[model samples]
Target: MFDHIQIKVKDLKSSKRFYTAALAPLGFTVQYEGGGAVGFGPKGAPALWLGEGDSRGSVHIAFAAKDRAAVKAFHAAAVPAGGKDNGAPGLRPDYHANYYAAFVKDPDGNNVEAVCHKEQ
Candidate 1:
């Protein structure tokens, strides 16, 4: 429903590093980078944009994973890249039978997540 989302972070370089690794497993790449801003998404679409600045507040952004394995990979990549674990990867029946996901807080404390909706 949304074309793109922009997030303000205290440090662009650090945020870029964190997100570059965090989103890789989900198949997102740094599509554009210049002028203190970086955009990430699939090949031609930069749906998530990160700009250098002071954030007004933390935000939660979730990316769709191809499968359960991708969700696990995102969690693994995030931690070493400077993310704090918010939730481990597993099935959350509360959300749905196949709502497998993981959550991590980025360097700026934004809740980043990867989720797969299909049953394995």
Candidate 2:
């Protein structure tokens, strides 16, 4: 429904590092960069973008994972790379019977999440 989403961050380098590691587990990588902005997603499509600027309001971005393990790995990699834990890997029965997700706040306080919707 969206072509891409952009976030304004306080530090470009730190944001880049955080996203690079966090999104890696979900198969997203830095696909393009310039003008103090970095784009990430599949090799041919840019879905999430980060740019240098004042931190904006908190935004939630969720990536679909192949399975529960990927959600765990995303949390593992994101925290050390400057992400703060918002929600640990677990089933959110409130959202759905099998909605397994992990949430983390980026350096700029953006809510990033990875989710898997398969029974486990």
Candidate 3:
């Protein structure tokens, strides 16, 4: 439904390190980069973008997961690579019966999430 997203970070290199490790579990990689920004997504197209800035705002970005396990893996990989846990992997009954997801705050305090809407 959407084409891409851009986020501002305090430091490009540090944000790159955090995102590189965090998004790896979801099969996304850095697709392009310039002086003040880095982009990540599937090959040839950059979906999520990070830019250098001061006082990075709290942003919410969610990735679609193939299944619940992928969400778990995302959280697992993110935390060890400088991501702070916001939530764990589990069903979010408030959203739906099978809204399995995980949440983390990246180096720049943007709220990143991975969710799977499949029965488990």
Q: Which candidate comes out best when scored by TM-score?
A: 1
Tens-digit lDDT track for model 1 on 45-115?
A: 99999999989999999899999999999999999999999999999999889999999999999999999
Candidate 2: list runs displaced more than 4 Å: none
lDDT of 2 by residue, 1-120 (tens): 899988899999999999999999999999999988999999899999888897648888899999999999999999999999999999999999999999999998888999999997
Pairs of residues at least 3 apart in sequence or in different chains that clash in candidate 3: none
Alpha-carbon lDDT, every model: 0.96, 0.94, 0.89
**Which of the two, 2 or 3, has more lDDT?**
2
Candidate 2 positional error at 44, Å: 1.3
TM-scores of all predicted structures = 0.98, 0.97, 0.94
By summed lDDT, the worst window of 10 consecutive residues in model 1 runs over 9-18
Which candidate model has the greater lDDT, 1 or 3?
A: 1
RMSD of each: 0.6, 0.8, 1.1
- Comparing 1 with 3 on TM-score, the higher-scoring candidate is 1
